[model samples]
Target: MRMDWTALPEAVTKEVANRIDGSRVLPATAGDHAEIAATVAGARGKVFVKAARTELGVRSLRYELRVSEAVSGSHSPAVEWHFEAAGWLVVAFEHCEGPHADLSPGSTDLGLLAATLQDLGGTPAPDARLFVPSERFGFAHPAMDGDRLVHTDLTAANLIVTTQGLRIVDWAMATEAAPWVELAALVAWLIGAGHTPEQAEQWLAQHSAWHEVDPAVLTFFALRNAEKWALKSRQGSAGWMHDLADWTGQWAAYRRRPAN
Candidate 1:
């Protein structure tokens, strides 16, 4: 859905120009979501902007802005401003410069990422209405209840490795769930980064949150996530979604293996 500045409506472009002082657009990375993703250079400085015209996209971006504002700046980029213009919902965030985190095995980025997650675990969910794991996933579980804010999308692309530290982006999928949910989400990312499911869990076990939850619950989460991703992939989602389905399936399989 990524689009260049020229793709925006004339009215939208004019509004953006006013907000940023001047408009020099550098289209952001091509992500599956966000119709207008770009870094705008202004007389003030650069600000990353995400704008959407579709109803779903607009709602998602607005919700993301709300959830993102609630998160501490240490964990996410600061929201500079947001407004609606000519049917587009646009939000600007402090421009963070860095490549995405390297999740491959033995990468130093793991430590930075782990620290960010640890800090996030301590961050309380915003008072604003947000989805809890059960509601978000459409399955009830007592273990899914918690007050901590959870960013379910832990893909490397969303984890910007800035000099300040690892700053997580894309809060559209943010949830208020148990501290363990984020760790659970990380398992699939590790698998995609070339770690076997067992190896991923082994690494995750070093964290306290991993042990706070029942192993049975983790297995259930893995199975449910795998089913969700697989269904999405089958339903004509992006081709890369198949990789998510595969990674989550591997984790579920590992968890379901009989104890020796």
Candidate 2:
């Protein structure tokens, strides 16, 4: 959830200070999760820093750090440094400068994002405790099974549109799933970004890997995703959960529509 950057504990601040020379902490207004999210600039350059003290938050951050280490290629920003300070686990990554990807129709970012996803699909799944589609969506099909790692969270916010191409951030929700699941998960975002369901699928068809997913699996994913987001929005409606609930519901309904 979007949160104001409060002053860090003196000891925590001091510890972070000791690590980066002439560091300046700038508050971050984006991102849904993270206890402390900010940009730290110093002698070297800017690094996006995310720190967490809560047990769940710390564990998630550590897992993401591990995943980041295993992931290679220019698609993801490199990890800068990470350390524990004042009981909080702080991790930093190369601060990539760019706006969140534009998924709307007619945006050039669509191609860049597609290329990035294709590149990321080639990264082998690291030896880690990873979530399967059923573990996350409560329903899984044979088509969802694969050895390749996929970034389950395809929200535009996680995709930075840099000059070189799109750079994906936040590996906290990365999962082990079929390559197609990566693009399948992006359908809702396309709808949310103003594409009709048919249009979204047409765009997805441009990728050869997308042709491999079973149509039944897409329908199942849409149903479960709609249900999942709806439940979460009811519990806590902030931080784009409600938006996702709406978009997923729309996609599901569109998929269920009768043949014209």
Candidate 3:
């Protein structure tokens, strides 16, 4: 269901407008159960807003706000600020220009993205309070360290390359997870887009440390992500899901097989 911004609690709308220097507000895009992507006029910047009417949505929105706040000042370029007023949570961020007409695993954009993740390794974990429990790891590996703040959801739509550098937008699903988790997710995403395993491995080799992690561990995370999209595909959830399940099952079986 799409939210009518005009009907948003006046205070929430006012706060968002005021933060953007009173820019003319225009709707940008809507996703899943949230309405987002608003352009702020004067500075020509954009702010993304999410409002939820259901109990689950409200809980998730709160979690997103917390994650945004936790990673705010870290070197990672994520959502800048979050404000809650009148039953809405608004996050303001510097807008990024183009995803470019062409974006792929081998694009220079991916190179820049890899470089950004490499730099994030140096960012200090802000506070322990923001640490989400291990079981809350989502797509991240449960055994991986949660010290560094992670974007968790680094899908193509969330990234944009601007004159400055790569800017990651959309923090609704961001969380603190293993540093390699982001890298693993990126690799998995490339595979799902049809890049061959060899190609994915080559791309991942660019980040040597991340590549050195147990291949099975990395593949497990990758396969889990693949199963998620498979479930959502229109072709029929069972087939795609089964394909991933079978691939993993076969991998497990082969790992346990006796030496030939």
Q: What is the TM-score of each candidate against the true structure?
A: 0.95, 0.93, 0.71
- Answer with 1 or 3, whichever has the higher TM-score: 1
Best by TM-score: 1
lDDT of candidate 2? 0.82
Clashing pairs in 2: 1-32
lDDT of 3 by residue, 5-93 (tens): 67677787677767766647666553453544465555535655556545676766666666556565422345657766766656665
Against the correct fold, how does model 2 do in TM-score? 0.93
> Model 1: residues >4 Å from true position, as ranges?
none
lDDT-better candidate, 1 vs 3: 1
Specify the poorest-scoring 10-residue window by lDDT in model 2. Answer: 1-10
Clashes of 1: 0
Per-residue lDDT, model 1, residue 14, is 81
Query: What's the C-alpha lDDT at position 85 in model 2?
Result: 70
